[model samples]
Structure formats: structure tokens, C-alpha cells
Target chain A: MTRFFSLLILLAVSLPAHAAFNIFATVPEWGALAQEVGGDKVSVYTATHGLQDPHRIEAKPSLIARARTAQLVVATGADLEIGWLPLVVRESGNAAIQFGRPGYFEAARFVSMLEIPPVLDRTLGDVHAAGNPHIQTDPRNLLKVGEALARRMVELDPANATAYVANYQAFAERLRTALVRWEKQAAPLRGVPVLVQHKAFPYLQNWLGLKETGTLEPKPGLEPTSSWLAGIVAQQTAQPARMVLRAAYQHAAPSLWIAERTGIPVVVLPFTIGGTPEATNLFSLYDDTINRLLRAL
Target chain B: MRTTLTAALAAVLCFAPSADAANDAALAEIRAQVKQMKESYEQRIAALESRLADAEKTAAKAEATAVQVATAPPPAAPAAAMSAFNPEISVILQGQYKNMKDIPERGITGFWPANGHSHGDDHSAEQRGFSIDHSELVFTAGIDPYWRGNLTLGIQDNEVEVEEAWFQSLAIGHGLGLKGGRFRSGIGYLNDKHPHAWDFADAPLMYQVLFGSHASYTQDGAQLKWVAPSKLFVEIGLEAGRGSTYPGTDENANGANAGAAYVKFGGDVGVANSWLAGLSYLQTSAKDREAEFEDVNGLAAQGLFDGTTKTWIADFVWKWAPDGNPSDRNFKLQGEYFRRTEKGELDCLDEEGVGNACDPAMSGATVLSNYDTRQSGWYLQGVYQFTPNWRAGLRYDRLDSGRRDFGVNANNLLVADYRPQRATVMADYSWSEFARMRLQYAQDRSMQGVTDNQVTLQYIMSMGSHGAHKF
Candidate 1:
């Protein structure tokens, strides 16, 4: 019996702990940021990939197990992950990463949020009262969130504080230099009236100063009906938009149909890191977004 | 007047030169004082200008640092802090219209009637026409940094019952969790899930046979679960409780009458597929358990059982969604099988005199001292979500009577050599995450020689703060 217990202990202690700090990010964007900020001091596990909608991903058992040993959890918390994050944390039983703890970090609180609703109601079709949670579309928000995430990492793993701070400084320097170039290249997109597939691009519009003409979705989350598309087609005869924009994860059919009818160009932006082949990192994500919009223009 | 004025001007001119000597000296003194004051004022102005320049330089440097990085720590969003102390509450309103035969005394064919089946008083069985099902009121909240509490009340018609009220530990390290109170035992896959979360409108024939009127095996208990610190999901749980529900009767005993242990393993096959499988065991003892069954002559008889029951359950589930985004489409397949054994003494209280209802030698009650039986049941189901709002499911259930040994009163009740089975199909549509409507049909052969065709239409709407569901 003693030998059996010793073997059990051996098995339990033999779990794979590859990194000094383990972080679970809810999306690829935050995962990329955590990697850049923590360098080799941390290991990140992204819950959802670029092809999946972060709002609707399942809380699979694998995710729960991943969360059980996580040292920190980074999320875009403007009610974006309200559906699944709470359940994951409760099931994980990891008190370090629960809400209000030092190890839990929300990115949205660092930057100024846009599109805050005046009324809170589900009749508006899944409106986030806290504002749009897709803040990663703009490079400025990424820098801000990265700075805060670095501080959180240092707080959790103080032994690696100097390494984390140094890495964040290097990353912030590169991002700031790239931001100036992206803004200048995207100057032509300013004041360009554009149609969007959904209300997912308010921060992008705010950053690039793109004018939103209409949305393909009838409401925030509802799919567009044929009649709504017909009405948009009729309106385009009088006043036409320069382009229709959509994210890489969205279905191409809606924006493609609109582009076909209006004869406008369809611009598919890699909304986050690893969303497309070209968008492999934080800087490339913005580069690919600007290149697409400029192509469309 | 001109001659007088010229004379006065000449006299004043004569005195002007004499007064100019004194005035010149006074003017020189006033000029010296003015120059001293001007020098002091210029010195102060130069000092103030330098200080302003220094302040501007520091301000500019601070602004530059702010532009380079976020200097101030980000404050948490005020909206995330809920201050009302109001627990998360959700109310589920459910109603169903069932169309089926009106068989008053409904019982599974081969399996012995469990508790709450006497005269068909089982609440698990649905009504004939339109009826309000068990609507649920759930409240959950964190008690403190270390614990959380949950309460769920099940209401039907004018009756209200506490279905689950438990408190769970929050800060137990080592991937360990503790829960205590009245809760549904986590023995099988579907046992812990509420009715609204079920794909079909009714329980399977296997569950109906084993648990009788109860939708799940519930007990007032305490549970301890541990999750292994591995990449692959592995969990082990143990439970002890007062077995006062189905299969075990409340005898006002001091110690625990039931205990359970389970272990689950799961992992992701790929980005699209995930699966979990588990095995569980439960044991309980009962005293004077009452049940109603038909004798060999087809007459209703009452039986009292006193003994121990042991059950083993194995469950498995697989879920698939393309790229792990279920909003577009998804599919789930689940199944569970249970084998049970009972060893006890069965005493027949009523001995009908007609035909060969008990031994002719017995009087009022017939006692079978060494009664031993073994029974098993299994169910499999598959649900496919073809669209974001529509889903369809099909399920099949079967039960085996297995072996039976009646010691003395063998002539009173003959062992049934039959297998009860059922097949069900359902389609449901959801307007949103909160509301769903389902239509289901089942060909039930649970009762002996009765192939009852059942159709049901049900609606479920959840309002208020509904939390996320478990896997």
C-alpha cells in the first residue's frame, strides 16, 4: 500500500509544467499580446482560435482542465465573455484566477470604450451595455492593454518582473512605431463611407475615421433577410458606399452579396492575430487590416 | 486786464528761478527712488520667467511619458462590481401537452416496481393533455471568498419543492471541490441535468424503471471531487448521503445509508470534437420499502422489501462542432448503461384468494426470506443542431429483467421474462437562448403487451439572470 501511494504521488507530481507562469487568454489577440509581453517567461493557452466566435465557444472539459492550473487569465471583459468565462472559473476551482482577484485581467477597462448603449435591453439584439468588446481592431488599444497585462504578469510572478517589463518595453516601442505608419497609410480611408456586415467594427471605424453607411445585419446579431438586402440595394442606387467590410471569421456570403448588387468592393480584414495567414502577430494584424482597406479603396 | 496780468506774470517769473533751485533737488531724489523700484521689479520678473520655463519642461516630459506608455494603473470597470447583493436568479417556465393512452397503473414490464409507483402516484409520468410541468426557480451567489451557495426550487401546480440546495467550496487548492446539502447525485450523465436542459420532454424508460417517479437520484449528502493536474481531463468524486429518495427508504437512521464513487476522463480529439466517459458506483440500504406489482394471476399486490441495493453506471458523451463554433452547427451523442443487484426479504402483505395468488398454505402475508435479483438497463441518444436555432434528436432505451430467485413465495410472483424498450424522436426550435419549443413522439413498449404511441408539445422559457451551462 505504501508503494502504491508513492506511485500515485509520483504520477500526480509528474504533470507537465513547462513554463514559469501559465496564462489562459480568451482569444488569439490577447494570447499574442501575452506572448509578446511575457516573452519566454510565460506560456499562453488561447481558449478560442481566430476562426471561432469568442462569444459562442463551448466550455469544453479540456478548457476547464487548462484553467485549473492557470496562474493568470486574460479576457476582453465588456460582457463579451460573460457567457462562458464565469462557468469556466467556477468549475476550475482555481481561486487565483477568479473575478476580482489579482490574477484576473480584463483588457477593456484600460482604454476608452465606444458605442456604450443608453438603454439596456435584449430587444436591441444582443447589445453590450458596457460597450464594444472588440477593442483589438485598433493598435492603440492593443498597446494600452499590453501595458496593463505586463503589470499583471509581474504582479503574479514577481521573480520575473524585470524580464516582463523589459519585454513589454521592447514590444511597446515596436507597436508605437508601427502605429504611426499604419495611420499614415490608412489616411485615404478617412471619411470613406463603408457598409459593414455587423456592428463589430465600431472601434476600427473610430480609429480610422471610416464613415459607416449601413450594416448588412438587420440588427446587432440577427442575420439579414432578403427584403433587407433588397432595400439596401435600392438605397445604393441613389447613394453608394465605397466598400463593404467584414472580418475573416464572418461568413463571406452576406458581404459578397452586397458587393455584387452594389458593384462595390468587399474588404476582408484580419480582425485579430492569426486571423489570416498574413496576420501572424500584433504588428502584422494591423498591417494586413490597413492593406485590405487600402486595396478596397 | 492785460496790463495787470503782464505785471503779475513778470513778478511770478522773477520767483520761478528761485523756486526752480528747490524743485530740481526734489525731482532728483524722486528719480533715484523710481530707478531702485524698477531694478527690483525687473529682478523678480526674471526669476518668475525662469520658474515658468522649468515647470513647462517637466510638464512636457510627463506628457511624453504618458504618450509612450500607460503610467496610471487601469481601474477595474465599475460595472463589473455588482453592489445590490442580489443573487443571480432565473425562473424557468415550462408547460407541455402530452397525448397518450390513459393507463392508470403504469409500470415497466420486467423490472420490479420501485418506490413511489404504488397505484401510479409517480410524478415522473406526464398527464394526458395540457399540463404545467415542473417550473424551476434557481438562485446562486458567492457567499464569500471561499464558498458559494445555490438553491433551486421545483414547482408544479400549487406544490413547491426544494430540488437542490447546496454550498460549494471556492478556494480549495489542489483542484479539489467540496459540496454539501441536498443535491442530485452525479452518478450518470443525465442525472444531474434538469429537465429543461434535456433534449426530450420525458425521461428514458431505463431511468423511469430504476428511479420510479423521481427524475434523478437525489440525496441530502456531501461530495468531494478532485481534478487531476494534467492536460487531459481526469476527475474523481466521492459522495455520502442519507438515502431517502428512490430505491432507498427513510428509516430515521443515524448513519448514512448510501454512498457513491465515480471517476471521469475526457480529452479533445481535435478542434471540432471532444468526448468524456465516466464510471460510477452507488450502494444503499432500505427498510420496509413499499412497491405495487401484479401477481402471477394478474391481480394487484403490495410488497415490502428490506435489503441492500448496489448499482453501477457507465456513461459516455461526444460533441462535435466545426472549428469549435457551435453557433452555425453542432452534434452531440450521449449514452449511459446501469446494472443493479438487490438482495433482500420481500413480504407480500395482501394474498388474494382467487386462483394461485400466493401459496395455499399461507394466510394473510407471504414472506420470501432470501430474494435476490439482478437487472440492467441502457439508453443511447443523439442530438444534432442543424442550424443556429433548430435541433433534432433521437433516442432508444432498453431494460433487461435479468435473473431472479425467490426463496419460498415463488408461487405468488413469477419472474417476468420480458425486456422493456422505447424509441423517441424530437425536434426543437429556439428563438434565442432563453426560449425553446419542442415537439416529440415516442413509441413506448415499457409496459408488457402495451405499445403506447406518445406525442408531446412543450415550451420552456427562462427569464432573469441565467448563467452558463456545464459541459
Candidate 2:
């Protein structure tokens, strides 16, 4: 028994060490961005999946354990995961990846935000109230986030800095080419008036030069009401909006109601990573949203 | 009709010409023209009056439309119908079953009849019972942008009681202002919140022995907590009454008196990650009667005798959540330890058996003793979250009564009634923020020959107020 124990111990010590930094991204979009920059030098995990609502996720113990071992942590801060993420990080006890530390990254820092609310109040149905947290819908914002991740990855793992910088340059050039193509395709869509289920596509609206006529929701965080729907219908009837747009995961009732009342085709756009089968990566998420808008218009 | 005739006469003069101008030769032509103009004016005035009447009618119609829209019934849609009755009420129900065996005479089982039989079969194994540990109804009202109130009533073991009734003033920037009756003391880790927040259904051995199962540490008090200039939280509280039958205690001893003054200081540190540490102190006198009884009947009446004593305690807590995020499935651990020393007298029996000799068979009389029993106890416990919903915990407790020689009496058969040592291991699965189930097995071995195996299964839920407080 003693000899067998010794042999087992020797086998454990003989295993090859994994030097790659372990990273935990708050959402899948950040996870894809980390993978783009880190390549094989980092292993990444995302707390929220494609189909889940990122705002209301319950903090489970498993997430804390993952954060404990992580050398780097990335999140969409602006209170996107405010309900649960802060408590998880506090419990993990890994000071290296804590907020403001070198290993901590907030993707919002890299992108210029839209819909930065001048006033914030919870009475408005849990508004992000700071700024729009859906900056990923803009291709320019995605490139900025990609570059920030690349810079942070190089800072944390200096040995792999060259590879990370090279990867980011290639990704940035490809994104620049895609941006030109998308702008050409979206040129005809400029100044188009549209209605959406939620304010999740402000960046996309800016990118395509679309005017957001209004939202179907009565308030930011609240569900739609009939009176609110009636008011929307009255407004839409007078102004005659072109299309009703909705995130794939948002409740379909309000969008369908607006579509029925206004005689406008409802366009279900993938707003984030894993929102649609084709929108698995950050680039595809914006591409799918633009294509859907073009097809609907 | 007469009013219309008068209004026509006025329109002819107002629109045609003045009376002096009408008599001139040009006015004579004007008079023929005036007669024609008067006739024309009458027709025009009649048309203008009709148009004015129609305008009044239209104005009334618009007012009626406004009222109709204002008082219109909501649209008959499925979603709208459900939204009208916003269900803001939430309930949390908890149940527990405890199976305990070989209970020691000084342990929790000693407070109640271990078995159904009061005197017979002292060695018989006790059967378990199902208890409604906590069934609570909570009502929360969002009065406005700056005010909210929460009232919670709990039913435990078929007894109804109020757990929390407080109104919060959230408008105070960075300051949490609250006022109400029956609030837990801001002392120990487990004292500030409900039992559902505990890893184990039963409190730690130290808490049970020191404060009993309910921990009458709550008082009718007023407290003000403010964020200091340095960002740490400083709370100061004063209570006018003593501990009561509920979870918190009245600071006063006898009637209404100045109970006690308590102050706590703590803060959260780290930009994203955070650590919380607190220090607290409480000083209160036990009821004069309780102290006098210990001196007279407990010590003097028996051969063992002593003077009166007082009670005081000091506590500290430190917790760190390194990542400062609650949703991440990562390594999270929290541990706390508390120590308390209580001073009091214990009465003993005389050598002649005059003091402790009740019925010789029923009462175990002892010989002379003269001393005060200074008792002390401490416990250490910790929990680590394996996932967001699952956690495991371990605890160890030891208590020592200062009266070591009191148990040495051959005639005193109640030697089993002394301080004991215990250890517990608990594992729980929290299914959601409001619901969880726990399974715990504890082993208790006393200084006497008794040993117990206790297994408890508890299901807990919470609603209405804010969720559990993190360490």
C-alpha cells in the first residue's frame, strides 16, 4: 500500500503543468473576445450562456469556485451584472482578479456608450440608468473591445505579448474591412424609423443611421401594458414607423402586438453572442442584426 | 327669441353706423342702405348666433371625450389583465425534521422532555418529531421613490410571532436609515438576521447554550447607522427596555429601564473584491432576582455557597469575499469564531442533607460546597461554496463550567448536567436566491457517558424583504 501511494504521488508530480492563464468572462461575448486575443495562451469560461438573460442570473457556488482560480476576469460593467456578480467576486477571495486590479477588465471602458441617461430612477423599471449596456451591437465598439482585451492580455502574460498583438492587428484589419462592407450595405437604411421591443440596439441604430421612433415597453425594466400599447399604437399610426425590431431572447408578445397594430413586419435580431446559431461570434452578432434589419426594411 | 331680437338690434347699430351719421343726406342714403344693411345684418347676426351655439355644443363634446378617455376601462388583453393585479406579496416556508439520540442532560434535549415519558424508561431512545421551523409571511410596500417598509410574521412550532417590522428611509445617500420595533442586535454573525441565513438549521452549540434556541438578543431599540468620512459604517443604538421572549433580549433587568448602549464599526474594502470586519461590545446586568436566586437557593441553600455575579461579552467578526462578486462559481469561504464568559453563583447541598433533600428518591442531594461558577464557551465554524447553489460547512464547540469539583459528589447523580463538547458537519444546496434545502449530521459527546447522533433535514425559503445579508 505504501509503494502504491508513492507511485500515485509520483504520477501526479510527473504531469505537465498548464502555464496558460485561466480567464473568466461575465458573458459569452467577452469570452469570444478573450479567445480571439489570447488564442492558445489562455483558457476562458463564460458565466452566462447564449440563451439566458444576462441581467437576472442567480449567483451559484460553482461560479465562485471558477473565479477563485482565474488569473484574469472580464465583465460588461455599467451595472449589467450588478444583481449578482459583485457578491461572487467578493466571495472568491482571489484578490489578483479583483476590480481595478491588472487582471480585472470592464469591456465598457473601451467603447463609447450611447443612451447615457441624464437621470436614473428605479421607478422606470430597473433601467441600467447609467448608459446603454448593449454596446456590442456596434462593430466599431467590438473592435475597440477587442483591442483592449489584447492590450490587457499582453500586460498579464508578457511572454505571449507579441502573439497577442499580432492576433489583435489581424482581427482589427479584418473588422475594418467588414466595417466598410457593412456601411455600404447599411447606407440605404439611413434615417429609417423603427420600433424595438427594448433599447438594446441603440448602437446598431447609430451604426445603420436608423431613428428609434419608440420602444414597445412602457418603461425600461417593466413589461408592456395595454394602455402603453394603445399609446404606442396611436403614436405609430400617426407617424407610420417602418419596422418592429426585437432581440431574439426578449418577450415576443409586445413586438407581435406592435406588428399587428402597425402592419409592419417584426424583425427578430440577435443582439448578443449565442443569440442565434449564425451569431456565435462577436462579428456575426452585428452582421446578423444588420442583415436582419436590411431584410426587414 | 326676445334675446335674439335684442342681439340683432345691437348688431345693426354696431356694424351699420352711428345714430347722428344716419340722419345726414349721405346718412339718408346710408339709411336706405342701413335698412338693406339692417336686414342683411339680421341675417348675418342670426347666422353668427347659430355658429356660436354650434361651437358651444362642440366644446361640450370635446370635454366629454376627454372624460371618457380619462375614465376608460383598461383593454381586455390577457397580459393587461394579469398586470392589473401586481402580485407583490411573497411567502417563505421552511420545515425541519430532527432525529436525536443519547441526548446529554445539559444539552438542548435537557430543556424539554427527551422522551414522552417524564419518569419512566430514562434509557429509552427518543423518537423524532416534524416541526414547522419557520413559515413566514412578508409584505413589502414601495410607498414612493424614497420610502419602503417590510413587515414579516413567522410561525414556528405552531406559534405565531412577528419577526421584523421596520420602515426604511432609502433617500439618505450612502446611509441606511431604519426605525421600527423588535429588531435584532447588530452583534454576532447569526444575531443580525433570520435563522434561514444560517448554514445549519440549528444555531451553533455556543449560541444555543448561551442564548437558548431563540437567542433573546433582540430589544425594542432605536438605531442610527451612518457611513463615516472614511467610508466605514458606524452604527450606534440605545434601547430603553430589557430582552423579551422573542429572538432579541431586553437590556433592562426588571421593569422599564435604560437597557443598554451598543455601537458597531465595520466596512467593505477592495475595488472589486471586498473584505468586511466588525467589532462590537455589550454590557448588561442580569435581573437582580436571577442573581439573588443563584446566591440564595443555588449556592447558600445547598452546602455549596457563593456571592452574586454579573455578565458581559465582547465579540468580533471578519469576512472576505475576494472577487466581491456573488454569481461567479469560484472558491468562496467564510469563517467566524466567538467566545463568551458568564459569571454566576450555584447553590449546593449541605452535608446534613437539609438544603438539597427534597424527596430522597427524586432529588439527588449533595454535600457542602462554597464557590461561584464562572462559565465560558467558544465555537468556530466555517463554510465554503462549491457552486452558486451548493455549500459545505464544519463546526467545533467546547464549553467549560468553572465548577469542576461540583460534579464529583457521589450522591449527586445529576453529574451528566454539565458543560459538553460537540462537532457538526453540514452540507446544503441552495436552489435559488429564495429557496434552499440542507442536510446536517452532528455528533455530540459529553464529559459524562452519554453520546448523541443528531441528523436534521431542513428546507428553507425567504420572501418580501431584501435577500440574505452576506458576511
Candidate 3:
């Protein structure tokens, strides 16, 4: 009996320590960003991946199970994930990551907005009524996300506050220098008329001084109709566009059709971190996007 | 062409001179006029170029500003994680496959006759088909800090239906506030929430018989629930909708006038562990108008004159764990007992296979009678996590049906029918938080000479923007 008790004690001692923090992120972009800030101090999981369309994700029992264990959660707010993420959180009953908790992080909190529709309606095809949720396309917003993430990490683990601040500073400096070079390289694209697959490139176009001649999607989130494509083709023929921009994850068929009809080069841009194999981190996402657009032009 | 020729002629005349002195004076005037025209043209071109340059610069600045602003931190927190006013939508797809053997020839009858048959016979490959068991898309939005609403649309077996749609106010402190729509009645344990929470993918025998194939426990109604200062909870609801038909008689054979009202009360007890017990009462009026049918020549008069039936259900759930850790081993025991009785007039026949002599005025007369049915079942479930990524569960359920009058009798006669008991066992292995593979076997010994068995294997996977798990 004494030996049995000793064995039990040994087994209990041998077990691994429980994870310190349980972090849930809405998408891979937030997951990767959280990892950069949390390092080994936290365990993070992403609800969506780069290969899938963010707008059409399906909820499953497994996702609910993950949410049940999270202590901290990060998500892209506005109406981007309004289609799915809230149900999982409420069902999970994770009080720590519930609304108003310190562990909850909304990445959109730090970014300024653009193209906010004065009037909103569902007839225009699943618009984010609050504006666009694709804020990660711009590099400067990422800098702000990094800073906000650092603050949250510090609050969660105050002992590592100095390290978090230092890391954030280093990341911001490197990003700022890179942005200057990217802006210079992309300067020649000023005033160039372009077509886009979705509203995902407003920030990019803003940065490069490019004109958005039109979008392939007749309306936001709506599939293109044959008539709409024909009209676009006719318009582009009469007044040519220099380039057509498409996200790496978008269906290539429509963009391909537009390119084939207009004789314009189609450039696939990485819309988020790790959106493409070459774009692994935040800085690399911008690098790959600017280089790809410049090459195509 | 004429205008150009006249202008050229006029210019030559203006430059021509008659004498040397006159020519010099005219030439000076011509030179002065030419220089002034040249200066004016130069000024206009410079002004236009400056305007163009300014426009380009402004556009560049605007573009730069947009980028800077986009990258900047938002003035307010994102509504996705913390805002109570935003709505969240979710879609789920689930499929299952089951193999049945030795199914009865009479088919498995239930509340609804259309769902009673197994689609195959005993000798054949019994049951083989894929079912989209749960194709649900749910939308939920928080109205404020203390109020929320939920709407769920589901499709199963090619039929579209509404599963649960209601609004709840959390600001009522210990009190619950609700309004509008149909939701699960707080009668039994399994009737109140999603079927995924059950140990097995399918519902228990008691649940199927009492509520029908998809369950009719939810109806268009309103309810108010309150949690007492003690651990007790009380709920009262009134509903108007279709009712379940089972045990050979369509409880609500008529189409429109079937409605019910119910009240339930339960409470939690125990110190270290926890246990809950609840009792519910329901009264519904039958909708069938064929209660007076008579076949004296065939001796098959099984009609009942009673239109109202009263049902009572008692249920309890007990949970135990040494450390109260879900990841570790734990035990749960749950059960429910239901008794239903109706007062009506039933046909009476003599033992000589002949109808008793009766006056014309007495034919199909109403008589006081009683129809009683009882059903009870329970399950003991346990879960043990051998590792973080692997866990195992075991569950067993048994159901017994008391004697009851069925529409048809043995040998195509008319009398009471006896349904035997049933038992089921399930074993499941969860591979990860997002994936699980389960195997279940169930047996039905309801008929004396007929016995049936079913084996099912199921796998589930999920993808997309899911929230975090609660501890």
C-alpha cells in the first residue's frame, strides 16, 4: 500500500505543467501576430486559415471545444467575423475572454477607417456596414496592432513588460524603415488606373496613389454576373487600365476573365500575413505585395 | 478656307510699308505687339502647369494619408470581441451512417408515422443511407450589455425547419426575461438544448416516443423563468402549436386546435458534487375527429371519446468527480419517467365475437374510460481522459414501456398492445478538441420474437473563425 501511494505521487509529479495562458484568435493573421508578442508564454490557435475564404467559414463542435478553454481571445472586429465567431464564444462560456475582459483583444481598435458607407443595406451584397474589415492590407495598421498587442501582453504578464516593450520597438522601427523604401519603389505607379477583384486593396491603392477604375465583383461579396462582366469589359476596352489587382486567395476565374478581355496584366497580392508562401510575417506580406505589383506593372 | 485666306492677306497688308521711314515705324509697332502676345501665352502655359502639379501633389498626399490612417490604431476597440451590439453568425454541417439488423416487419413506430419505418427489411442490408443530420446556421447578436438574441435555422432529412429562435435578457439578475418565437420546453434534460451535447448522436428512446422523431417539445409560445434565492428554479410557459402522436393513436389527429400549457420546477443540491431534479405537467387536447368510428361487423371498434390527455414527467441528473476536473475522470447519471392518462369512452364487445344489442339512440354513445401509458429510461455516462488529445466515454440507456391500448391488435384484431424494453451502449474516442470518432451499438427487444441491433460510426470536423473555449 505504501508503494502504491508512492507510485501515484510519482505519476502526479511527472505530469506536465498546465499551460499559463489560453489564447484564441479569429484568424491566422491575429494568431501569427499574437505569437510574435506572446512568444512561449502563451498558447495560441487560429479559427481560420490562409487557404480558406474568411467570409464563408463553417462552425463545428471542435471550434466550440477550443473556445471553451481560452483565457484570452483576439479577433478582427467590425462585421468581418460577425457571421460566426460570437456564437462560439458565448457557447464556450469563457468568462475571461468575454466582452470587456482584459484578455479580449480587438485588432481593429487601433486603425483609422476608410470608405465608410454613409448609408448601409444588405441589398448591396454583404457589405461590412461599418466600413471595410480588410485593414491588415496596409502595413502601418500592423505597426499599431503590434503596439496594442504588446500592451495586452504586458497586462497579462507584467513581469515581461520590459521585454515586450523592447520587442515592440524593434519591430516598429524595422517596419517604418521598410515602409519608406516600399513607398519609394512604388512611386512610379502614381495616377495609374487599375481594376481590383474586391474592396481588399483600398489601403494599398491609397499608399501607391493608384486609381481604382472598377472592381470585378459587381457589389461587395456578391458574385459577378455575366452582364456586369461584359459591361466592365466594354468600358475597359474604350479606356484601358494599367493593371488588375487580385488577392492570392480569391477565385482566379473572374480576375483572369477581366485580364483576358482588357489585355491588362493581373497582379496577385498577399492580403494578409502568410496569405502566400512567400509572405510569412507582417513585413514580408507588404514586401511581397509591393514587389508583385511593381513586377506586374 | 476663305477665312484663312483673308486673314493671311490682312496680315501681309498690315506688315507692308510704302516708304523707308513709314516701314520702320510700322515694323516697331508690329514687333511690340508680337512680344506682348508671346508673353501672354507663356504666362497662361505656366499657370496651367502649376495647377497640374498642385493636383498631383494633393493626390499623393491623400494617398499617403490613407495609408498612414489605416495603419494607425483605431480610436475605439473592435466590436468583434467585446461589443454587445454586434451580431455573430455560424453555420454547422453534420452527417452520420448507421447499420441496422433484424428490424421488425411492423417497423419502428413513433409519434409521427412517416418517420416510423426503417426503409428496409430484416434479411436485407437493413439500413444504409447518409443523412445530413444537422445543417444549422445560427445568428446571435447582443442588444446591450445585459441582453442577447438568438435565431437558428436547421435542415435535416431534406426538410427545412426552425430549431430555436428567441431573445434573452441577462440583466434581470437572478430572474430570466424572454420574448417571442418557439424554443425547447424546459421539460426534460435533452429537450432544452442542441443534440450535440448528448452522449450519443441520437436521442434516447423515451425522448423519441414522447416528443416525436425531431421532438415537438418546442412550440410557438412565451415563457418566464426565475432562479430563486435558494438553488431552485421555476418556469411557466403557454404554447399553441402541433402536438405529438404516438402509441397507435394520433394524439392530435385534427390539424389546427392542438395547444398546451406547462409548468416546471427544479433545483440543484449537494455540496462537493451536484444534483438536479425537475417535475413537469402538460395538458393537450387531441385534434382527431374520428373518435366515434365503429365497425360492429368486423369487431374492430377501438375509438376513444376522450379528447384531452394529461402528462407528467419527473427527471433527475447527478454529477460526481473527486477533483471536479472535466479533463479527468467523471461520472454522470440521468433519468426521466413519464406517465400519461386520458379519460374517454372505448368500445365494448361480447366474448362470442358479436356486438352487444344496443338501441339506435345508444349507438356510438360516449362512455367514461381511461387510457394509461408510462415510459421510463436512464443512462449512466463516464468520461476519462488518458491524455490531453485522447479521451474515452461510455454510456448506457434502457427504456421500458408499460401496457397501453394500441390502434391495432394481434392477428389484425383490436385490443391493447404491449411494447417490450430497449437498451443501448456507446463508446467514443475524441482525437482532439476539433475531431472525434465514435462507435455506438443499440438493441431493441420490444417485440417478443423480434429483436433489432444497430451499429454506428461517426466522425466530426470543424473549420473557420471559432472563439476560445471556457475553462
Best by DockQ: 1
Better of 1 and 3 by lDDT: 1
Which stretch of 10 consecutive residues in model 1 chain A shows the poorest summed lDDT?
A: A1-10
Model 3 alpha-carbon miss at residue B172, Å? 14
Candidate 2 residue B398 Cα shift, in angstroms, is: 2.6
Task: For candidate 3, write residues A78-142 as lDDT tens digits.
Answer: 66766556655554434456666676788876677767666655456556655678878777777
Ten consecutive residues with minimal summed lDDT in candidate 2 chain B? B109-118
Which ten-residue region of model 2 chain A has the weakest summed lDDT?
Answer: A1-10
TM-score of 1: 0.86
Q: Count the backbone clashes (under 3 Å) in each candidate.
A: 0, 58, 21
**Fnat: each model in turn:** 0.43, 0.01, 0.05
Candidate 1 on A6-97: residue-level lDDT in tens? 23433433445445688999999999999998888888999988877777877788988888889999999988888888878877767788
Worst 10 residues of 1 chain B by lDDT: B1-10
User: How many angstroms is the interface RMSD of candidate 1?
Assistant: 27.3
lDDT of each: 0.79, 0.57, 0.57
Off by more than 4 A, model 3:
A1-18, B1-182, B185-216, B219-471
- TM-score of each prediction: 0.86, 0.47, 0.51
Instruction: Please report, as a value between 0 and 1, the fraction of native contacts recovered by candidate 3.
Output: 0.05
